[model samples]
Target chain A: MNESPVIELSGVCTRFGSQTIHCDLDLQVAAGQIVGLLGGSGSGKTTLLREMLGLLRPSAGRVRLFGVDLDDPDLLIQRTVRRRLGMLFQHGALFSALSVFDNIAFPLRELRCLDEDWIRRLVHLKLAMVELETAHGKLMPAELSGGMVKRVALARALALEPELLLLDEPTAGLDPDRSQNFVELVGSLQQALGLTVLMVTHDLNTLAGLATHVAVLAEQRIIAFGPKDQVMTVDHPFVTGFFGADRRKLL
Target chain B: MNAIPCLRVEPGRVVLTGSWTLATMLPHLADLQNRLAVPLPAGEHWDLSGLTRLDSAAAVLLWRTWGNAWPEALEIGELHRQVLGRAADLPREMPAAVKHAFHPLESVGRLLLKAAHNLRGVIALFGQVLLDLAYLFRHPADFPRKEFAANVYKAGAQALPVSALVGFLIGVTISYLSALQLKSFGADLFIVNILGIAIIRELGPVLVAVLVAGRSGSAMTAQIGVMRVTEEIDALSTMGISRSIRVVLPKILGLTAAMPLLVLWISAVALLGGMLAAMLQLDLSLNYFIENLPRAVPVANLFIGLGKGLCFGLVIAVVACHFGLRVKPNTESLSANTTSAVVTAITMVILVDAVFAIFTRQIGVPQL
Candidate 1:
């Protein structure tokens, strides 16, 4: 209310035909805050992210990112916004055809006007951050282990030095140790790089350990949104139920 | 019920109207005109007073019913202009070919252009395969060690047995035929000529190339097609890796490099097989057959056979890649494309062989 929030949502509704996936939802993220998008699968966390990204238009209500209405998404604004966002998709979704270097170079190739040498240099820098061997840059994705694939894809997402990092289940399909390592890598990078992070994850350790803020989506709306410690309280039944979701509840 | 808008026909200067939504009543117009052949009414002016709404169905129906005689067609001016307007000037006198520019005929033209583009893409793909072959040495490192081993195993080693069997049968038949013919001249020694000339010069390379085309060509298609379906190709593209460079070029290079080697080996083996048959049929000594075989044929014939084998290798690679690219994103399409690749490669091989046959004769092929 004092100034425009980093992300502002009001009465946002998304529907597919008669099935109303999310309706009349509202949430906000203040400037420079990392937020956890917490929900079980099919609970509209991804859809909400997509809506914020303007990939899907809300059937109703206003979504203002920093100040831009997501409904009438300005292409120029979207491009600027996208340049600031780094998305780590499920299974890392690393372009299987690319080498580790090119995989890391993708966003730079797409979003930046950097030449090959600079792109290569940036790729190696990112590879070092993820602690992946630069020699693996020459190998195809099929040659990599699951953990390395995730690291390379993460490196690609960071290629453009994005301000906002969106991770969709970053720790899924990893061993507990690898998952913890990935989360640590993300938190340390968030601090060092001064980035805003919005992550969709079912990992309890991520919420407890990595998040600065948390937003729990239930009944097609954020039931609670605040700093991680405040939001983690067992006040709402849905929030409690989700918090109690076991480690085995995830993929 | 009071007449609601049934069909509001408006196209150019012709108008016809009825009281019903067009979708339900549109089919009735066809039935009304069909079988009975009763001329539905038309005039210089049409009545749209009975109509309430207008759409595409009514517009087309009116045009088809009165297209021949109507000096010009009726066009829907606006919803409020419910009656047929003045007779618009239209070039009805234009030739049928000229009018064909306006309608369904344009769709036919589109079809032909599509076919042409598809054919152009195919020809372009063939060139791509050739270019890939020419540039093979530049990036030979792109081929994975496993891929090379597989290509050698799949294309060369695996294919030899079939070629050997075919070559064996062919050798036995040639020996039998030679013995039957050369007995008349009491020059059963010509069986050495038959075994040497036939196996080394023509049959060996052609038979081996055909065998590889069926086996290796089909395998390439299936592999690429599966990759296409599985999004492995997309994985490559999104990875900023060129499928042409990484996936396709390697196989083409492997085949081009290995094929001539295989052909030469199989031909020698096939000749040996013929030597065995020569012993059985003509009771000819191995040394006699082996020694005379080289003199009876020249290097020119070997060159011809090897050249054809190279061309066939290129053709198989291109054909397989073509069908692979043609594969729809489905397993069924993968299977279909694999079959088509083999069939098309073989067909093209035969057709090219005929062309070569005609060409060599016209050019006065150097007789070995």
Candidate 2:
């Protein structure tokens, strides 16, 4: 593993209207590690993800991505840092007005460096990467089925060839078969592109299939963080209850 | 790790190095494009093994630069070759956008069909509300009384201040302008007849109709449209509730019930404004204006005004509900339906008012 961390959260705190979600939370994700963030409902899993994306600022401490502070004042540096990571929202928040092709091409077009031909080719490559047909590009987001919506959203997130991928419930709505296919797709893509992934998921199948490292969050902090099997062996209530009888099957 | 992407031309070879990713290439894109455009020797060797990372964007650029073919002599890693292979495998032709040839006659026919279809939908919705009313009459327990009251509060009670403000301004403007004309002709008393008849019979209903159409009508469409988009309407139907009884009828009936009251309120306030302006400009006494108003404008005109208010209210509500129910499940459809609801309600109110004008002209007019 690389020594330098791709994401570092040190002593982070999040409070909402007299309710504290996270206090003094610290996590360091090294390069190319698929960290499955496990937590019970309302345990601030999505909140932590949003904090990392800079969509929400922690009340205290620092959030650093690629070794640069998210609070860095320089606009150009912030933009550069943002372009290095992509996030997939829980509901596949695709733009309703744009076609699937335009949605995927949106980030590339923002660069203003790639020409139309290159964008067209890159968009096709991304669609293929997500196992979608080229014809799917012509459909609107509203027209897509639930599975297709997830795929299209994934394609759009991967548009800029982001080094870090953040997925919030990537397979929440998919059936077991489709979710398995999605897991395999993501696993192969992660290996090919050497992407560091941070995913929040409740599905054990997804966790077992893809995550190289596991981080269990409880009591407003990460209770355990290490290689999957090592983290599973940690004597924490959340870890035991979460894995339950399926611990050996995961191995 | 953060070396700038460079393409160096050496003897008998082209060497590409560094992290050739989008972020690294963005600033030097123009320079790279310029250098890549220059012709190289036919049999030159290309070296890309030194590159630490290569994103698909860089792969596409390289694929395009090499004349859509591999270099004669090239040294590249297996992973880089796979990235390049994906780009090269992209289909040459893009999917074509759908096109239609313009035909004026067919276009006109389609528009007429659409209008007829909309008219049928409005009539059907009106019939459904009537049916729902009949059903509620037998089972008064099932009536959406709270929804009706809420709609009235939102559309009717909340609209009072704005209506009064607009009504007062129009009354002042018309009364002041007429005072100027009446003073020159020594017909100052005639100002009472003009203001009373114009405001009570025509302006009150039409003004309130337009305001209500823009305010309450658009809101009704948007509320129902969003419900449709989020499947709330479907959820309601799945529970065995008639949407027309619970959703559509309350809005139409509430607006219908509130509109006549709104017209009466606005007309009374507007007369007060006209009275104030008359006092300032014509030195007309309030007692004289009030006492003689019954004789000058006649009581039938007040009845005509209230009747027009009732009809205008029904038409506006029906038109608004009609367009609201027509909304499809998309943002574009929601916005389009809301706009069409407001516009169609106002237009229908004006059209109904014109018909009322022609029919009631003889009843409301005083004999000279």
DockQ of each: 0.01, 0.59
Give the C-alpha miss distance for residue A88 in model 2, angstroms: 0.9
* lDDT of all predictions: 0.68, 0.90
Task: Chain A only: list TM-scores of all candidates.
Answer: 0.89, 0.97
Question: What are the per-residue Cα lDDT tens digits for candidate 2 across A18-44?
Answer: 999999999999988999999999999
Candidate no. 2 TM-score: 0.94
How well does model 1 score by local distance difference test?
0.68
- Give lDDT tens digits, candidate 1, residues B182-229: 878898877766666666656776787788888889889888888987
How much lDDT does candidate 2 score?
0.90
Q: What stretches of model 2 exceed 4 Å from their correct place?
A: A1-4, A59-61, A67-74, B99-110
* Model 1 lDDT tens row, A1-251: 22677678999999989988888999888766888899877888888888887778899988877666765546776666566567887777776656677677776676434345434544555676677755777776767887887888788777665656788877777788878877777776665445678889887877666888888888788888888767767488777677655523321
User: How well is each residue in B254-325 modelled by candidate 2, as lDDT tens digits?
Assistant: 998899889998998899899999999999999988998888888888888888888877887788888877
Candidate 2 CAPRI level: medium
Lowest summed lDDT window (length 10), candidate 2 chain B: B90-99
